[model samples]
Target: MPTPDTRRALFARGTWPEASRIAAVLRLETVGGALLLVATALALVWANLPGGTYEEVRELHLGPAALGLDLSLEHWAADGLLAIFFFIAGLELKREFVAGDLRDPRAAALPIAAAVGGMAVPALIYVAVVSASPSAPAGAATGWAIPTATDIAFALGVLAVVGSHLPSALRTFLLTLAVVDDLLAITVIAVFYTSDLAPVPLLLALVPLALFTLAVQRRVRTWWVLLPLALLTWGLVHASGIHATVAGVLLGLVVPVVRSQAAGGPDAGPGLAEHFEHRWRPLSAGFAVPVFALLSAGVVIGGAAGLADALSDPVALGVIAGLVVGKPVGILATTFVLAKLTRAELDPSLRWVDVAGVAVLAGMGFTVSLLIGSLAFGQGTPAAEHVTLGVLLGSTAAALLAGVLLLHRNKVYRAIEAEELVDEDEDGIPDVYQR
Candidate 1:
C-alpha cells in the first residue's frame, strides 16, 4: 500500500482531475440544457402570441442543398439536427459496453435492474392510465410506453446541479442505466411502435453493418473505411423506414471498444471508442443536443392542450407516474433482491441510502425519452404534444429531486468487489461492444 502522501499524489492526477472533468462536463451540459429550456419557453410564448405564427412554426424541408445531399432545415429543430444527438447516444452506449463501468456484470447489475424496472413499471402504469380514446383511440394501449424512458442528457444535467460532490459512482450508475433504458426504448420502436414494415433499406443497412462487423473481427481500423461505411448504413436504414437513429447504433456496434490485446494487431491502440469520443464528443454535446432541444422541446398552449391537460390527461398521467414512480422502485427493489440472493458486494464507499438516492435520479429520461416521442407520437395526434409536456415535467422533477437527495451523502467511491468477473489482465473485459 502507498503512504498517505503517495496516495495524495495519486489523487492529484486521477481522483481530483477525474472529479474536475466530471464537474466541467456536467456544467456545460446543464447550462446548455437550461438554455434549451429557455429557448423552448420563448418558442411557446412566440407561438401563443396574438399575431404570432404557430402554423408558420411547422417543419420545413431543405429543398435547396449545398451538395447533392437532402437535409431538413425549415423551422422545426427535430427534423434534421437531432441525428447527431442520437449518434452520440450510440457512441456513449458503445463506450460503456467496452472498457467502462459496464465492462463487468456486477458493475452493471444495479443499473440494468433499475432500468428494467424503470421501463416496465412505467409502461404498465402508462397503459393503465391511458386506456382511453381521448387522445388516440386504437393506439391507446401502446401510448403508455411514451413516457417510460429516461433522458440521459437531462439526467446528467440535473446531476450537474449538485456540483462536484456528486459521486463518480453515481455518474457511472446513471450512465449505465440510461443505456439499458435506450435499449428498451429501441426494442419498443422496432416491435410495438412501428406503423408499417419496410425491408429493402433495412437489408441494405444490415449488409453493410454485417460487413463492418466482419471488418472489426479482422481488426480493420481505417477511419476512412469505417466512416463512409457508417454513413452508407445510416442512409439505407433511414430509407428502410426503421428509425434512422438506430442506424447509428448498428454502426456503433461495429466499432471496436478497447485497444487490441496484441500490439501487432491492426487495431493496436486506443480503439474506435476513444478515437471517436475524442474527436466527435464535442460536436454531439455542444451542437446536436442543443439543436434537438431547441426544436423538439417547444409546445404551444391554447387548449390544443394546455399544461393542465398534460397534467390531467390519462396518457400524460401514465407517463408521469411511470417515470417518476416506477424507475426508482424497480432499481432499488431489484438491486436489493439480486445483491442479497447472490451475495454480490455493494460499493463500500457508498451506503444503501446513496443507492436509493441514485435510483431516484435515474428517472430523468429527457433526451432518449424525447427521441422515443418522435418515434412514437410524431406522426399521430394531439397526445404527442401532451406526452412531450409530461416528459419534460417528469424529467425535470426527477432531476431536481434526485440531485438534492444525492447531495445528502458524502462518500461516493463505494468499494464493490465481484467474483465472476475475474480476468488475468488488469483492465477487465470490455462491455462497450456487447449491444
Candidate 2:
C-alpha cells in the first residue's frame, strides 16, 4: 500500500486545457441558468394569476395524430424539448469518459460512487418520509427518484456567481457528478417509470438509430441528413412507451468524440461531439430547456394557506427533505468513507466544508426533478402540483444556503490568492504559472 503522504488526493485540479474548456462552458451556462430562473419565475407568476389561462395554454394540443405525435404544449416541452437537454448531457458524458478527466477508472470511481449515494439516499428518504405519512396518497412512493438529479446549469451558475476564486477542482467535480447523476436519472426513468412497453416500435427505432450512427461515424455533418433520422428514432422511441429522451442519449453516444484516424488521429482537432455540442448547446440551453421550464414550473399556489397545505403533504415534505438534507449528507458521507478506505485525502486546497457546500449545491434539482415529478404523478394533478411546489422550495433553500456558504469560502480563497500573487511577485516568478 502507498504511504499516506504518497497516496494521491481526490479533487486535485485537472489538466489546464480541460479546465479552460470547462470554464468556457461554465460562462455560457451561467447565462442559461439565469434565463432558466427567469422563465421559472414567469411560470410561477402566470400560474398563480387569477385566471386559469396558464393551464389552458399548457394543455393546448398540436401535431399530427396519425403518427401518435399529437401532444399538449406541456407534453411537448417535457418529451420533445427536454430530449435536447438530455442530448447535450449525453454528449458531455461521452466526452468526459472518452477524452476528459474521467477516462481513468480510478478517477471515475469517486464521482460515480458519490452520484450513486447521492441518488440512493434521497430515494430512501422519500420512501421513508412518505411511508410514515398516513395521509400520503397511494402512489406517493413513486416519486422516490425525484430529488436524485442535480441541475448542471443551476449548480454551475451558482458556483460561477459565488465561487470566483474557488479551486477549479470543485467545479470539475460538480460537473462530473452531475453528468453521472444524469445517466443514473435516465436509467431510473427508463427502468422504473416506463410502463406498457411496446417491443415493436422499440425494435423499429434501431433502424434509424443505426443509420444515424453510421452517418455520424463517417463524418456526416449535414443537418438535413441527420435530422430526419434522429426525428424518426425519437418518434419510434416515444411510441415504444420509453421516454423519447432516451433517443437523444442514444444519438449523442454514437457521435465521435475524437477525429477519425483518417483525419490525422485524435490529437488533430476537436471531434464531432465537440462540434455538435457547440452547435446545439445554445439552442438546448437558451431555448429548449427554458421553454420547458416555463411550461412545467407553473403551479397554482392558492395563497399562503395553500402553500402551507402543499408543504404539509407528506410527499412534498419528503421531496424537500430529500433535496435539502439527504443530498449533502449522502454525498459527504460517501466521499468521506471513500477517502478513508482508499487512504486518500482531499486536495490540499479543499476542505470538508468545501465539499459540504458543494454537496448542498447539488441539491438544486430543478429540471430533471420536475420531469420526474410529472412522470411519477400524472402531470397537472394535485400531486404533481404539490411536487412542483416542493421542488421549488427545496431547490431555492439549497441554492440560498449554498450561496451563503460558498460566498464565504470564496472570500477565503480570494485572500489566499492575493497572498500567492504577492509571493509570486516578490519571488519574481512569472504569473503564467497561475494558469
Candidate 3:
C-alpha cells in the first residue's frame, strides 16, 4: 500500500481510469469465491449429515419477537446478511446504468432483451409446471423465480480462471446479460418473496436511506458517517419483514457519482462510492459470497441417499429444466432469431457459435439463485433441497459444455472463420494446404 499522503494525493486527483482499476480490485471478489468453492462444497456436504448443517451455522441471539416483526438468527442471516449481497448487486446495477455496459442504447439492447426473455421463459415454464400440479408444494411454486437468476460473479470467476480462449465480445455480452438478469431476480424477490411488512419499522428503515440520498446530493465524502445509518436501516428492515437485502440495493442507488472528471487531477467525486467499494465490497464479495455458498450449496452425499425420491418431484424437475434447458435455449434462440431477422451481427471479431456456447455458461446461477431459493423456502423442505440439486447439476453441466466449446477452436465458430487468409476451393478447404 502507498503512504497516507501519497494515497491522499491519489484520492484527491481521481484521475484514475477507476472503472478498470476497480475491475481489477473487484476481481478478487470473484477469485476468492472460486478459491472458496471447494471449502464451501466440503461444508455443504458435511452439513447435510444428521448434525452437519447444524454444526456450520451459529445462531445470533436477536429478538425472538418485535412489535409486529419477529426474527430468529437464521432469519436474520438469510434476511440480513444477504441484504448486503443485494446492496452490492444494486451498486453493480447503478454502475452499469451510469457508465457501464448498459449505458449504450444500441449495444445494450440485445443483452437487456435477451436477459428479459431468458428470465420470462424460465418463469413461465415453471408456472405452467406448477399449474399442471397445483398441489406441488409450498416452496415449489415460489421456487419458479429462483431459476430465473444468473450469478455473474461466479460465472465470470470460472471464465477468468480459464483465460482467453473465449473472445472479448462474448465475455462482454455474457456480463451485460447477467447484470440485467440480476436486476430482474431482485425485483422478483422484493415483490413476490416478501410477506406482510410491519409498516412502522419499514418506514423507519427508509429514514436513513432518504437522508443518505440527501447527503450524497450534498457531496458528503466521508463513509464513516454512513455507518450508523447503515445499522439503523438494517435494523429497521429486519423489523420491517422485508428482506434486509433490499436495503443494500437502496444504499447502492444513493451512492455518490460525479458528473465529470477534474481537468487533469485524480481526485474527483467518486469519493464515498469508491472508498466503500474498495474496502467493504471486497470483504462482502470475497468473504461473504463464499460463506454463503458453504452454508447453502452443501449437498449431502450420503444424506441424499433417498434423493432420487426427491429428484422425481416436479419442482425439482422444473428447476433442472429451467436452468439446463430453458436458459440457453431462451438466450440463444432469441438472440439468434433477432440477429438474423434484423440482420444484426455482433462485432466481426465474435462468432455467433462462440456466443452460443457462452450463453450456456451464462446459465450457471450459483450464489444469487441460491439466495432467492433460501428466501422462497426459508424452512428446508424436500422440494427446496431438490431444487438446489437441480441448480447445481444444471449449472455444472451448462458451465462444462460452454467451457469445452470455448477452450478449443471449433469449425462451427462462424464469425472467427470470417477473418482468414485462406484461399479455399469450392469444398471449403485451403487448396494450397490441402495437397
Best by lDDT: 2
The true-structure Cα RMSD of candidate 3 reads 6.0
Q: For model 2, where is the 10-residue window of minimal lDDT? A: 6-15
Query: lDDT of all the models against the reference?
Result: 0.66, 0.89, 0.69
Task: Give candidate 1 misplaced runs (Cα > 4 Å).
Answer: 1-39, 50-58, 63-80, 132-138, 210-225, 260-268, 303-305, 410-435
Best by TM-score: 2
TM-score of each: 0.78, 0.90, 0.81
lDDT tens per residue, model 2, 1-112 = 6554443232133334564455456348688899899999999999989879999999999999999989999999999999999999999999998997679767666677
Q: What is the RMSD of candidate 2?
A: 10.1
Residue 216 C-alpha lDDT in model 2: 89
lDDT of 3 at 191: 83
Winner on TM-score between 1 and 2 is: 2
Clashes of 3: 12
lDDT of 3: 0.69
TM for candidate 3 is: 0.81
Task: Identify the runs in model 3 with alpha carbons over 4 angstroms from their true place.
Answer: 1-26, 50-73, 130-135, 263-272, 299-304, 341-345, 409-435
